[model samples]
Target: MYLKIDERIFRELFHTYYDRLYTGFYKKTGSYEQAQDLTQQTFIKFWRYRDSYNPELSVEIQLFRKGKLVFIDWLRKESKERQMIDSLQQQEKIPVEELSADLKDSLNQAIDQLSPMRKEVFNLAYIEGYSHKEIAEKLNVSVRTVETHVYKSVQQLRKILALIFIMLHL
Candidate 1:
């Protein structure tokens, strides 16, 4: 079985889909700008794939599914951008005297997995440039323990970040 889609039919189909796709994305994401962007992108996909339209597959269903994926991709990109921005803000608040960009990105990934006390001690010692004695006094622990936590935390954060770097390169 074969179907021929003319320019008039394509225009009509596009007209019917444009509003529905925008509404679907608006409901999913609650952002008019994002919805409008996805709506335009959906039509671009429509134009690019016009020759492959399959009447048996139900054009409306296909369009809806493609539009949904586009909206979801946008959502993922927006979420990642927010995370990167937050990490940058956190890094900025730490004084420049103690920061290394590679170390900060590593610490962000590893700090969450540290024990609460170790995280506190390690941040003071490395991020705030506090000595072991000062970190110990601040956290009310012995200097030896503060030194140990900083040593361990640095080792673990480096390993965690090495894996992240490898995965990114691959």
Candidate 2:
């Protein structure tokens, strides 16, 4: 018998897939909270795009594909923005570095915490002045993934440094 999925069906799907989706994303992105956010996002996308359902196909499969695509697309966007920010940071165009040695060191420390891949991406783009294409070829990943990693890394670095500043001042 074919199935008819309603709002309740979607709700149940959300609960059922939440942990699996979150775990999959967390493995790729290496953040618990980010995984949680992406899990919620996957469900959100499922709700918004529910009309695309094909009852002939498995509902679980549809949901899983959608969630994975959403996560990948998000990562791609985040990486590009990170590359841009890396360029901006390299220029020291702002007076932020002029603030204090402690602040600068804290910022450096947080950057130092990133995965080797992320650090390499940032360094090649900003410090070594490598193009995204070049970085992608060197890293054996698509340039799009490179951009996503860069964006997420920069965003994470910013948040980490901000918290460090607060803690240092306190």
lDDT of each: 0.72, 0.78
Candidate 1 per-residue C-alpha lDDT over 57-153 given as tens digits, one digit per residue, 9 for 90 to 100:
8878777777777777877976875565345335534564476787566557778878787788767865677766788888887665675576666
Candidate 2 matches the true fold with a TM-score of 0.52
- Scanning candidate 1 in windows of ten residues, the lowest lDDT window is 84-93
For each candidate in turn, give its C-alpha RMSD to the true structure in angstroms.
14.4, 9.6
- Model 1, residue 39: displacement in angstroms? 0.7
C-alpha lDDT of candidate 1 relative to the true structure: 0.72
Per-residue lDDT tens digits for candidate 2, residues 1-170, read: 43556788887887787888989989988878778888888888878877767878888898888888888898897787766856754654334436577867786798798888888887787557787788999989887678777776777788888889788889
Stretches > 4 Å off in candidate 1: 1-4, 94-170
Which candidate leads the pack in TM-score? Answer: 2
Q: What are the TM-scores, per candidate, against the unseen true structure?
A: 0.50, 0.52
